[model samples]
Target: MDLNDLFMSCKKGDVNRVKQLVEQKEVELNVRDRWDSTPLYYACLCGHTNVVRYLLKSGARCEANTFDGERCVYGSLTPEIRNILVKDYV
Candidate 1:
């Protein structure tokens, strides 16, 4: 699939599709959309814990920022996700 599909999968919390795309299909794990939102950003924003963990393990960058200049950690919708992103960097 394409980057849009990857983003959609993350938003939908489809961790399997995300794994397939990132692992087998070899899609860039950190690609951002027009909004400058990466898959990890969407997963965090949507509160997909599994997706967030999977993306983290898959080496998705936590430093990706939104168009508004908010980091993914700041944009995260849940404390768990925020912890994950922060833990990675710190």
Candidate 2:
């Protein structure tokens, strides 16, 4: 239920843990941590494609103007992820 757990789960690429937290806790998906990064941000930064997809599919925001948002694109490990963000943004 804690946001930290969700963030860690995403960063660790624990898809099941992320799924359980996102489903059971129903916490605000876009809630920023002390680092001003969201669950999706960590997922993207760590190049966890599945985590990023799950977050995006669950309505996570990826605005182009935001630092984290832009960084998500720059930090993504694959073009598929970048395409996902671009397509979603557009």
TM-scores of the candidates in the order shown: 0.83, 0.85
Worst 10 residues of 1 by lDDT: 61-70
Top lDDT hit? 2
Q: List the residue pairs that clash in candidate 1.
A: none
Candidate 1 lDDT by residue in tens digits, 13-90: 999999888889568887878877788779988999999899878887655344422577777899987887767642
lDDT of 1 at 74: 76
Per-model CA lDDT versus the true structure: 0.79, 0.84
How would you encode candidate 2's per-residue C-alpha lDDT over 1-90 as one tens digit per residue?
588888999999999888887788667899999878788888988888899989888888888788767978987878888888888762
Q: Give the count of colliding residue pairs in each prediction.
A: 0, 0
